[model samples]
Target: MTPITEVEGRRLPLSNLDKVLYPATGTTKGELLHYYAITAGVLLPHLHLRPVSFLRYPDGPDGQLFFTKNPPPGTPDWVMTAPVPRSDDPSARQVVIQDLPSLMWAANLVVEFHTPQWRSDAPAVADRLVFDLDPGSPATVVECCRVALRLRERLAEDGLVAYVKTSGAKGLHLLVPLVPTPSEEVSAYARRLAVEAEAELPSLVVHRMAKKLRPGKVFVDHSQNAAAKTTATPYTLRARRTPAVSTPVTWEEVEACTDPGQLVFLLEDVAPRVGMYGDLLAPLFDTRGAGSLP
Candidate 1:
């Protein structure tokens, strides 16, 4: 018989508890679940009312990976879902994890949690803008850090406060909170900023998506601000060889980062960091105080 666990009055049958999900570190599914449970206080706020897309590595990081926007077949009746109208299909529905039990249910199957810039209730409006600073081969997170610092300054000049985070891979992500604005406008503004950054730092920045142009430069990926695009949600574990989380970082940490390894945060480091820093990206939730696009 499958062992059942009760989380906040919701009974969930968890499978393969000891199954290794991060082969390099030997991190198991049980540990991943624990990480989600512990960080729920901070993680849930960002996910609240947002439709999530799951990146699943059922057999571990080395196995086949797939992306699913809709809830899986066995998803419980109590799990909340919201309709997301697609250009091809209007009846499509996506899972919304509004509470602890719902999070755990998703965590059991998902290695990475991805969400759009807008919430479920207002899918056409963006509440934040994001720039994914991806460093190319010879360049590393160190290069991304330099680019992020410069971008932060640029956003500041425009009266927008930007927050930095690790991508849980090799780069960094910078986010700017915004008052509700149309997704197209947000995407346009982000694109404009990317172009400006490329012009200002022609030697270090590339705004275009072509991989050939990325070597020795940080690609300022502003296309994630699009309505259909999604970013790896903060606090979500990446499906790398090891269990590193997409973690929020202080500008001080970003500034002090000299080695790429310094920005890599594992699952074990998150809860303690949350205890000490209490959600560095908390300001993103203040929708009323969010800055308007200039």
Candidate 2:
């Protein structure tokens, strides 16, 4: 049964409040909505006006998952959506999340994570460049961090700042803010940078997406920077057994950190951490000072 709840003055009908999304941690759907509500201050800015595609897990993370780009039929008109071109049909519009109310509405729909595009329409520019450092079976988040630190140094040499975050799984993400570069240009730069990083650190990084080659190296995935590709929005709880989050961390922590588990922020840890870090990647969304690549 579903129950209608009030969120930010909007009515949200949430089903299975006690339904366990993360069985190991017993985290419920209600808890997920609450987390989004509490972290909206830091999260909404990243989601505002950006196209979003959802990975819905109707039966929780342990069950089957499906991806949806359009607002399901019967969606309320109050929910904001954008009409982005579909890959198969350029004219066909795909719905996107644009505000907090829409965000909460998605949570109720069993959207496990809020993943948004890298660009926003008003600014009409690539807001950030992302590096998805995925570690293979033998390689872990700890190893991913080592690779992240190295990439950070390289980005510094390139005259850009990189922010670190856990991938909510066994990996790390390195995001760099850009000043309105074309999505294609940003994607090209990311790809070249990843390839360069792989070439420079062949022993530590893998540039390809093949699963077999990733066994003992960090996969420096640069493809997420493309125009329509999405990355997990910060502060969203991951669909993991323990309900881990894609959390932002400091470079200091990245260098000294050995156990990746310690850095796995939870839904409960966000508010206080944001209090301390004040949205470490928030500047990535600001395009007012958008400058050309240095």
Candidate 3:
């Protein structure tokens, strides 16, 4: 019989507690549940009302992985969901993790939580802008940091404040809060910034997605601003050889980082860091005070 637990008055059947989800670090299913439960306070704020796309790795990182925007077949009826319109197909009802029970319910099966810049209620408007800085081989995250610093200064000049976070992989993500704007307009503005970054730091940055040009440069991916695209939600665990988290960081930390290893944050490091610094990306929630595109 599967072990049953009660969370926020909801009955949940948690199984495979001993199954290893991260082979290299030996992280198990139960540990992942605990991580999400403890971080729910800080994590739920970022996910509230946003339509999430789950990236599941049921058998672990080394096994098959899949992405699903719609709720899985057996999803409990109590879990909140919202209808998200699509350009090509009929609207799909996507999962919305607005509270602890809903969050833990999804976390039990998902390794990565991805959400668009707009919330489910206002699907046509973008509430934030994202820049995914990916470094090519020989150029690691240290070089990406150098580029992020320059981009930060540029955004400041435009009256926008940018917050930094680790992609939980090899690069950095810079997000800027915005007063509600059309997604198309936001994407255009982001592309302009990417172009400016490339021109200003040609030797270190590349705006286009050409693999050949990325050998020793940092690719500034601004396409995630599209209404149909999604970015990994902050504090969400990434599927990798080990348990790493898409953790938020301060600009001071970005400025001080020189080694690639310095930015790598495992699941164990997140709760303590949040306890010390609070949510560094908390400013992203101030939609009313956010700046407009110049």
TM-score on alpha carbons, each prediction = 0.98, 0.92, 0.98
Give me the candidate number with maximum lDDT.
1
Q: Residue by residue across 1-294, what tens digits does model 3's lDDT show? A: 889889999998888989999989999999999999999989999999999999999888899999989889899999999998676657678999988988988887855999999998899699999999999988999999999999999999999999999998889999999999999999999999999999988999999999999999999999999999999999999998889999999888899998988999998999999999999988888766698998
Overall local distance difference test of candidate 2: 0.77
Name the lDDT of candidate 1: 0.92
Q: Per-residue lDDT of 1-294 in model 2, one digit per residue for the tens?
A: 578777668887877888778887788888888888888888777776776677787677788888777767778888766666666866654455667778788878777454544544632257677899998878888888888988888888878888888877778888887776777888787888889988988888999999988888999999887776788877667766777778888888888888867778888888899988899877676656333565
TM-score of 2: 0.92
Candidate 1 versus the native: TM-score?
0.98
Model 3 segments more than 4 A misplaced: none
**Candidates ranked by lDDT, best first?**
1, 3, 2
Itemize residue pairs with steric clashes in candidate 2.
none
What local distance difference test score does each model get?
0.92, 0.77, 0.92
Residue 134 of model 2 has an lDDT of 93
lDDT of 2 at 187: 77
